[model samples]
Target chain A: MIKLEIKLMKNILGANDEIAALNRKLFAERGVVVMNLMGSPGSGKTTLLEKTLVRLVDKIKIAVIEGDLFTAKDAERIERAGVEVIQINTAGGCHLDAAMIQKACTSLDLNAIDLLIVENVGNLVCPAEFDIGENFKAVVLSITEGDDKPLKYPLIFKESEVTLLNKIDLLPFTNFDLRSAREDLITLHPTIKIFETSCTGGTGLEDWCTWLLQKVAR
Target chain B: MHEATLAENILNIALEAAKQNQAAKIFKIGLTLGEMAGVEVEALTLSFDVLKKNTPADGAELAIKRVPISAVCNKCGKIFQLESYNFFCPACDGILILQSGRELLVDFVDCE
Candidate 1:
């Protein structure tokens, strides 16, 4: 028996990254801005999408792709808000990969849409690992989830280009520290855009929508 | 939780490589996992062991090399190892930019 040694240096995520690049090119050619919205299970992502769509649908055409573990509950909610929505059930998977998004895009009219918002699976750890061919990644971290979350799950915050500090209306009731969270997040990503939002009162929705519109225009 | 997917990818890549090299059997697979790659070693190993059966890489040993997270200070230019996710520079209080962590790669394959 002869011992054979093979030397190969390869990236494990090379396939996923390749598909993501293709998706990026397609989105660019279609002139549609895509955003990957991620957060915890109860991070108010659905509510945030509702608020955003209600505000921006009249200004620009928008569509959505909703990802979940089992059901179309979130997609149903987005549909009620008045827009074209596609649902992807991961069937017990933890995250949405680039290939999934590429397949889902086939059913939609990319020419008619100005923006495409993909609501990733509700996972702080796993979702951060996969790139779903988004122009930008935004993470929603509600105030009630504890301020230590930024330091604990640094990858999600670090990977995101924007952060929605949601549930600001409940800040008075919770012990969440706004200062430390900001500091930690800034330390991790110095140029990250931060927005404080409250879907219930529509407190910071205008600023968030405005920022998103600006990104789309550029 | 996604380690299963990663393990499957690893095995698929190794098998493809072994077949390309005209090898009959795979004896070992080597991996390089970094501190900030967000992969759990034990779970990855378990998934690889389970998925690698009934193939050329059956009973293959997973040799993983763990790498520590390190960064270079922008202001002071001192390289330092980071732990517990604190990225503040110890020398000049400047934010330390990442230098070496966040790697997830298949290094090599051993077969005959």
Candidate 2:
């Protein structure tokens, strides 16, 4: 009896999927390309956005919805980067859900923005469960975080459309097995686009930027 | 930590399903939480108890199924269960790509 009950407990995700579909439709109508940037804390997600803002802010009107457990620091940084930014302080929340993101969207001028980047609260697990009305999910993995990360957190790697292996500049200092990580990631998600980047040194930004531009344009 | 929110989502889904089926009472709410889901089962149960009070699903039992983390190794082509935080195959130190078991879903419902 217990085994049967457990086996039937598989449809809960369908509920979340329904909500996500509705969100996807709403975003499409507005021509807003939403990217959910997910990563462990200190994976250089904000830094990448900051650097992008310096280069692309003039051409593409970008807005960010920063999800953090505490503090308005990230939002402030983006604001200074010359883009419309809103911060959703989840307090102790681990992930940013669609409901919370929908509320955040109200504060932005959606009509003027081409891209809406949601920097999800630094988590690889919980964030993958919730869809924050995004076109695609992006995962940032620092080389310092270990190459074994892709295998340990395969869901994030599989769910994400693009994986940014950030902090490559630190590879020389650390024993991060980049080849193994890429191989692991590719095995799980055959089509996932992997970008090697260092947000601090600005290496491999051009490829990432090009990918973002083409994706958003579509 | 976020188990409370997940419990809320479960209740929301149960309530919606109850409404959809026009069932007077929800007998059971089922869930499949994967091993790698990062959700604490104890936290979910505690949150469910608190949130279920006064709702139609108050007495409705929550059935949570735990799935083992199983992956297929790219190098060895062998299926094996993962141990601890290790996500690599023990046979050949190959990438253990998740094949199944990480099922965060509500498969069915028992209503009357």
Candidate 3:
């Protein structure tokens, strides 16, 4: 047998990165700010998006791509909020790939939107690994998930530019320690912005909306 | 869960490399996975085993090398290997800036 060694040195994420780069270029040309929202199931990602839509729909032209495993439940809810929404049912796939985002973009009129929010599949681990061509990643961590989440899933916390601590209204009911969670998040990501929010109570939604508006403006 | 997709990517890369080198068959593929990459080695190996069949890299051995998370201290500029999840610098106890441990690369391929 003959021997031949080829030093490829190719990145595993190279394929995804290329597609993501293309999506980023397209978004830039359309002058749209895309945000990839990631988190665990039941982390209130959908609720937070609804709350954001309620506040920003009047000021900014927003569109959403809701990713789920099987049902169009989240997409339907977003439709009620009255913004242009598209649903991507991964079927059995755990994460949304760049190719999927590219296909989804074909259906959207990007030129009409100011902000495009891709609500990634409700998985903290896999979604963080794949970049779907967003300006930045924002993770929603409900207080009920416990403060140890930052340490347990450091990659998601580390990869995210902002962390929204949702369900703050349930803090008194649960044993979640906000201070310890903040400290842990700081250790994992030195400068990550943290937002405490309760979608139902309207707590911290104003600040979150203000920050999002500023990001879109920039 | 995503290991299967990752394995497919690895196979694609191997096939492309083998074709570029004008090789008939691939023998081995070397991969570098960072400790914090969130990919399980066993799952990825299993995925490769199942997906490699009927491809140019069929029966090829996959060798994965795991790299520990390393960081540089921002305050004192000290480089250190992190043993645990805590990212504090050992020398200065300052905020540690991650230097490595997020890599997933197809390092090389052996073919003939």
Top candidate on TM-score is 3
lDDT of 3 by residue, A81-192 (tens): 9999999999999999999999999999999999999999998789999988899999999998999999999999999999999999999999999999999998888889
The iRMS of model 2 comes to 6.8
Give a tens-digit lDDT track for model 1, residues A1-218: 57788888888888998999999999999999999999999999999999999999899999999999999999999999889999999999999999999999999999999999999999899888887789999999999999999888988998899999999999999999999999989887777899999999888999999999999999
**Best DockQ goes to which candidate?**
3
Q: What is the TM-score of each candidate against the true structure?
A: 0.95, 0.79, 0.95
Q: For candidate 3, what is the recovered fraction of reference interface contacts?
A: 0.86
Q: Ranking by DockQ, best first?
A: 3, 1, 2
Indicate the fraction of true inter-chain contacts that candidate 2 also forms: 0.37
| Most lDDT-accurate candidate | 3
Better of 1 and 3 by lDDT: 3
lDDT per residue for candidate 3 within B1-112, as digits (tens), equals 8888899899999999999888889989999999999998889999999988887788799988999999999899988888876776767758888899998999999999
Name the regions of candidate 2 deviating beyond 4 angstroms: A1-19, B15-28, B33-43, B49-61, B65-103, B107-112
Candidate with more favorable, higher lDDT: 1 or 2:
1
Residue-level lDDT of model 2, residues A50-146, one tens digit each, is: 9877878877878999999999999999999988889999988998887787778777778788998999999877898776668899999998899
Clashes of each: 0, 9, 0
**Across residues B1-112, which tens digit of lDDT does each residue of candidate 2 receive?**
6688778878887777777766666678878888877677889889988998898777878777788878888888999886653455678867677776667777666776
